[model samples]
Target: MPEFNEKAMHQFNQGLIKEFRENGGKAVSGPFVNAPLLLLTTTGAKSGKPFTTPLVYTKDGDRIVIIASKGGFPTNPAWFHNLKAHPTTTIELGKEKFQAKATITKDPERQRLFDAQAKVMPTFNDYQKATTRQIPVIVLERI
Candidate 1:
C-alpha cells in the first residue's frame, strides 16, 4: 500500500474539523465511537490562543487520554505544545462539554498506558513506525 499522503491527510483533518464544528462535534461513529471519545480544545501555550482538535480517546480510570501521534509524524503535534504550556483545556463528549487539566505522561508510565490503549486500536503501532518522534499521550483529568 502507498504511504499516507501528508497533504491529503491535512486536507482531511481540515474537513473533519469543519464538519465537527458544524455538527456540534458529534463524532461520525463506526469503530471510532466504539469506545467513548471526544473532541478537545487546547490553548496555544506560546500564542495563548485556543485550537480545537477532534481526538480518538479512551478513559483510564478517571482521566481521558488522547495520543499525539499526528499519524506518527516526527514532531509533536501543536496541541501537545499547547497543553504543555497550559495544562488546562476543554472537552466535548456527546452533548456534554466541560473543562479539564492536561497531564503529559512521560516514559515507563506513558509506555505502559500507550501499550494498553494500542491494544484497543492497533493502528497506533503503525502510527509509531510512520514517524520519528515518540508519540506523547496526554491524560486529561476533569477539574
Candidate 2:
C-alpha cells in the first residue's frame, strides 16, 4: 500500500468536505459515498482554533458514535485529543448542524459501540486488529 501523505490527506479531506456540504451531507465521490458521514468541528488542543474533520458515524440512541481509528494508526487522531481537551463541539449531519458534547466511552459500552459500528462498517474490526492501542469510541450527544 502507499504511504500516508498528510498534505494529500488534508487536501482530499477539504474536497470531501466541499462535496458533503454541496450535497447536503452526502459524499458524491470517494470511499465515503453513500456512507453515513458527519462533519465534526473541534477546537484544536494546542492552537485553540477550530478544526473540521469528516468522519463516518453510527447512531446510538440519540447520541452519535464515532471511532478514532485513524486507519489503525498507533496513536489516536488529532480530533480525539481535541475533544479530550474540549468536550463541547459541533456536529454537521445531513443538512443540520448543531452543538454536541463529546464523551469517550468506557468498558462494555465501548466494546458494544465498537461492535455495533463494525457491524455497519467492517473496517473498524480490521482497524482494531491493526493497532496495539485500544481505539477510542466516542459518543456525541446534542447539547
TM-scores of the candidates in the order shown: 0.81, 0.97
Pairs of residues at least 3 apart in sequence or in different chains that clash in candidate 1: none
Clashes of each: 0, 0
lDDT of 1 by residue, 1-143 (tens): 35657677667666666656566665464444344557788888888888877788877898888899877767777888888888889998776789999898998979988897898888899998887778998889988
Candidate 2 clashes: the total is 0
Instruction: State the lDDT of candidate 2 residue by residue for 1-143, as single tens digits.
Output: 24667788789889999999999999998899999999999999999999999999999999999999989878788999999999999999999999999999998999999999999999999989988999999999999
Give, for candidate 2, the lowest lDDT window spanning 10 residues: 1-10
Q: CA lDDT of 121 in candidate 2?
A: 100
Candidate 1 — what's its lDDT? Answer: 0.79
Q: Candidate 1 — which residues are off by over 4 angstroms?
A: 1-11, 21-25, 29-36
Clashing residue pairs found in predicted model 2: none
